[model samples]
Target: MRKRRTAYLSGLLALTVLSGCGSSGHSSKPSASPTAAVSWKFTTLDLGIPDKVLKAPVTGKVPDDKTLHVGVTLKVSDEAWKKFGHGKSPAQRAGDVGKDLGITDAQLQKVQAYLNQAHIQAKTSKTRTSVTFDVKAGQAAKLLRTSFVTHKLNGRTYFTPDPNHPPQIPEQIKPYILAVTGLESYSVAPKARALGASAPGRALPTRAGRCIQRFPQKFASSQRVAAAYGFNQLWGQGWRGENMTVNLVEMDGYDRNDVANYVACTGAHIQLGNVNLGATEPAVGAEATLDIQMLAGLAPNLRIVDYQEDPELLNSGNGADSWAALNNALQRIIDDNADKKRPGSIVSISMGGPEGFLSQPIMQAIDQSLRILTATEQMSVFISSGDCGAFADRQYGSLDVSFPASSPYAVSVGGTRLDLAPNGARTGEVVWSDRSSLSRCENQWGSGGGVSKVFQRPSYQQAPGADNRYAASGGRQVPDISAAAINLPIYFRGNWVSSGGTSAAAPIWAAGMALVNQGLLARAHIFCYGPDTFYHALSAGAANRPYTDVVAGNNLYYPATAGFDLSTGLGSPNLPAFFNTLAANPG
Candidate 1:
């Protein structure tokens, strides 16, 4: 009997505080019970300020100077922004990314002067990319080059700018202000959970195989991922992400006890890199723990930077009230590695909400940020597509995808279920689309994917067959790639657990990318690789090997195909072959 997170999330998200908090491995509530996933947080947690409070600022029409609040991002200069586009390695990259990009003293003074003129008080970040200021509706209306108005979405009222025109700044400050964010008053939270599900029974094994790592007798561990994906061969090469760094963007806090326990169990050679993106939460569950442990198990020596942000900011758009928290975290990473073209290799974001909830301007803003990281800084963000599958919001019942994943700049990771024989040999893999027809289960969760309504088809995706036969017209495709995502065992918080979702697929890809970066850096002095190189390599492989074609299963809306399909794009990674190819000719 396994516990699932969906059940608890369905009941307003209760949580149990860890006893002796910092001691690590001290959970006040024992999870040894079979139904540990049940909401046993000791007390019911109020979700805080209701959605109606978000609509409080919306006053009839024109807003007062005191009531009108706006969020701003003082971005880099044009030249500094352009530097990230080149394919040079971090060492070869010129200039310190943050300092050069930060608002010059002269520019800051001018902004401060302008704020005084507008009677606005704003806070600036150390990096100067994220700014939070309050201004009269009149001032904000002029700066954004647009006016604010009340809008109705899903029977809810929120404040937003007109859709006809994009935001703009006066010519004098245009050079310094990369973008104007935080226009929306309210934010929408993403409904996703790090839940686990299992099929009825295991399939028959072919050739004898062994589990990846031994676990306690009480819990079951399968090495099908090891035997099937060829992680064994990569591990054998000692390419254990020794020098690479994987920055993970997590929505919730993590349990250090889980990290210590995972390390003790798997002998992972690493510690924690904690970067607080927002105020700390009271208690955390398996999400962060699984992300860290999985990456450590796959690439034990890889340096990890956990960018912990306020989960409230998640699913919030650039203009939304809590938007700056997320933007601040991403920009910090870009600036920290600004010393080089690609200071970091991969960043995994296992959290995202339905794309429909995000405003067009907000989504566009996030897309630009991600593009800067990948196209310019040489980083690939592996984002979990979402666990809600095609119908991100079951209440709406529309085939919508998730944000960040839908962003063309990210490598959206979908899910799959691998069937292994008793011998540990993999028989085949199918989309991890488990909509239980049996009694007692009503969850319609799997992989989130579909043609994006916000983003257009990027040049990298314009290639023939990039869009499947059923591909939606006039939009970008999701899940550029996929991995084994279902019913995998993860060691966390001093206990063994089984879970699956695109959350599992994301880190696996991040680890693989780390391996690729390690290999590329080993052979060349400075390396510049992007989706173009990665996509071209997919077609360049001998008979297009290295990636197993997942022609079975569907995500309720999109089906898997031979080449690239919405379900599992380009299929799962085939190890050394992928890394070798990406390294040898990273054109």
Candidate 2:
């Protein structure tokens, strides 16, 4: 009906399955009937928070006076999800994504009425899908059917909800909702650190053509990136990521001077724009600096919209997570127009933490939100598969997977150790398995990957070459792919620093996806957004030259093999062949 982009879909897509990488002592499922409009009197669906989050110990001392700000999510209805699958025009698709179609005015009024009944005031978002409101420790305990106490994590004190029983959803808004997140409020960041003895980067290298970039510095730049990735052939064919826009969410602001200086230093032709999402502190962090530099460095001609989020919301000394900011950013990207509109080619999120530590409701909420992007909006979202190789577990030796990255719809990117010849030519690459070898910090070596103790194996993942050995576990795996994560220099905090992690790897896939979308924005509604052709191409690369299967190294526990393994996933994409395969896409 919609130009049949669905042809690229390989197998049955478990579009409704909601799970994460977190492990549960036992399985739990939230009850929601799609067809039932049950009574409003005692109609409350009890969705319990995961035990792992409740059981996680805190670190900081609780203050005498502390308030709880619970984040609430209203699920998107099934009708809105059908828009992407059924709609034809961009406007038709954006009609809902541009705004929160999850909750109606009537539903909002009901929620507000409930809030008033509880004597609690809520801060509703512009989309009306997310709300942030304050509640006393006792008030929250009664509202969500959970017990609350102050706990410290990472030296910060905040409220952690211990659900003696599952959370309740009012029957009045039952069938219309998907997930209501924000039971816990802890967000993690990119797992990267400085490479010791960072020096001034090398000068720019000479370029043969006008379209290709020129990198002079010893630090990797946009030009050398093209050469190293075997994109030379495509650049000659006029495929330099023009007419594309990549949406990146770093939850932190970046230095304007640093970005401009990187462009000037590298002679890149890229442009960077920012959509401020209520951030008060405009000061930039090193992570933001490196993220922007890497995107512009790879796809120099591509437009990047850095969706800057509220710093207070991002790192609210009270263990605030990225859910609110990410939701706001994604909604803006979907609804954007006039000067702020982007092409919606791909999204890159280079941050994450242990999936199990994240609450189940939050994971489901994010999963449904991503369903809007991948299944509905037809946009590709590439999330970095964390830097920690498995999670810190001394008891059962469990390898924890990262959240958001482990979401079924996301193309999870791992890390790799890249080696270049003296002349800056590619030599060899391996899985970025560094266990205490790269930093004094723990869990710094290899890329973040492992089995999803939460999510089941989606239908698309059930196909061949998706690690057949793990069928017994019947869960999702961490990284679907990987790219360069080591031996590269990035400009951060006024100095050039060498850094690598899964954070560095995600942008590679995202920028590459932008190039795949170049000259095809108007047809974005027909593009394959999920793990369709790209996964096929990656799988083909293994037997062919387009993919380099890393048969060595491990992510703490799982080993890299000739095929799909948790360490390097399908191994790094071979640029020439990978692009060739993507360009040949009929969509």
Candidate 3:
């Protein structure tokens, strides 16, 4: 969601008008309901596209030969999801998690048999709670009783099932099915939330002090920004993120040379690792390097793992392949920690798409996974709110936030511009909205924050001062926290280039969380604090002072306020204060 955007308001308006006319040249009417001979009665499974997406202009028919990856999420009742979290440890809880969940072995076998009869290659996850498989687009459309077509919206292409016709499943299996994913794919994949003028054809600013000339903003060194946010306070107290591990969920690959250069420049000792879940290592990019180097500069002595997603799955031809890939990586993280009996690790994700850009089923599946990670698995997950301010879908002045950042389970990190004195003390900070000649909006390239259409406000938001004025009735507001995002320098490729986005903000919080976890583990022998704990602690007395309230500026549509607001949520953190507060009330 951090990739530079082109104005698409006019095209989107036209597409919205044209799509309501009728089908876009492909007829995929099923011969019969459920479309196959089965022992049980069937019912329609409504995985309807969001109104914003369903109205997009159809560009063409999906190619029949393109292979589609599909994931079927089996139902685990709310009671079971809550009951499974009662164990003493995450591993102990997971030991019976699959068994306690509703999906029986016989039920899984029945589903597998159905797929085998159709000759589709499929396999269930280790938990036996979900099944994943690959099938041709034509055959999938036939089996799902729908049509596959390509649509163009906001200068990006997406392949999806027909909104007019919903998919059908057996009534017997319907009770066990939560949702399905990978039926919709982005041709232009979601991007990492890092900004820079180093991209090809972008002209650097003529100003000598500006770091990334394309944006022409004055850059702040990573060390200076860290100091302003209280990293020095934590370090002085002997908490340099030791014995902490953070997994960075990334869509692109990074370069080791750049990581090395950044570490050398920052003089931080850290361990680095990578887990490629079928993704190809493309040429080095700014986003991945920026994420790693930012952590390196701040955490000093932490373990970082880059979980890379597949490139093929990110293309237009692969329907929702990127989404499937993300799910797989998430499940792997849970399984790895559980199988090894390791403590819950922090997860940092800097990539996301607007909630409306994705279908309902896709968001539900991802949110379900996040719920397990934060609620059941006890891991702290932080994600970038986005780089498009309130206009995530590129609708100009319209408002929208990104997901899974908007998922109630995630800590949505927003962006801010920090002004530091010569002594590296904080002078002023505001919502990050920078507009130069190359910008598209009056408030271009600001932090992404707004109300979520898909998710309801979570229990934690019920805390005093967490509610926002712009949130719709029962809607979720973002972001949960803010950080210095603008003018942050990172060693990319061969040089120390700088840019700003919620991308930097996410890792900054992740690094801070790692240190906080180390302190908690040392004192209370606890793995990691849950989202609810942080919410309750920060919401309590003013004596704690865990965060510095950001009460200035706006993300186009939402303005910052005295307490919680859509722009900066609880504002930027005071790390030592935050850790001390958590130590006092270690939930």
Candidate with maximal TM-score? 3
Ranking by TM-score: 3, 2, 1
lDDT of each: 0.61, 0.59, 0.69
For 77-118, candidate 3 gives per-residue lDDT tens digits of 777766544324543464655566547867765666556555
Candidate 2 accuracy as TM-score = 0.77
Query: For model 1, how does the per-residue alpha-carbon lDDT over 1-587 read when each residue is reduced to its tens digit?
Result: 00000000001011112221111111122123223222212211111223444344444444645255344555656666665454444544445444555677667655555554445556665445555555676677664566666655455666655443334444455555544555664456544346552223322222212223543322223244655777667767766777677887766767776666556555567645777756556246567766876787677677787777666555344236444555556766765665543343678877676676655445554665676667545677788887766766543257887887888778888888777665556778888786664222223467677888777777777433575565558788877778877666764443456766788889987887776666556565434344555576675566436677788988877777777888887778787777666555555
What tens-digit string does per-residue lDDT give for candidate 2 at 1-587?
12114322111111111111211111112222332233345344444444444555744433323565455667666666565553243544454342445577667666665555557766554445555565665666566555655555446445555434445656665655555544455444223222321334532233343222422234344455557665555556565666566777766666666676666665566656666766555556655676666777766676677777665655464334456456546655544531132434678877665665555666676676666666655677888887667652211255678877888888888887766665666677777766545333343656777788888767656323575675479788868888877656565655555665677778877876666555234333234456554565654444445567777677767777777788777777666676555445533
Instruction: Please report, as a residue range, the 10-residue window in candidate 1 with the lowest summed lDDT.
Output: 1-10
Alpha-carbon runs more than 4 Å astray in model 1: 1-70, 73-82, 98-110, 118-130, 133-179, 191-193, 197-223, 312-319, 340-344, 395-397, 437-444, 462-464, 470-472, 492-494, 526-528
- For the record, the alpha-carbon RMSD of candidate 3 to the native fold, in angstroms, is 10.6
RMSD of each: 13.4, 9.0, 10.6
Off by over 4 Å in 3: 1-38, 50-61, 84-88, 91-96, 145-166, 185-188, 197-218, 312-319, 437-444
Q: Which structure is stronger by lDDT: 1 or 2?
A: 1
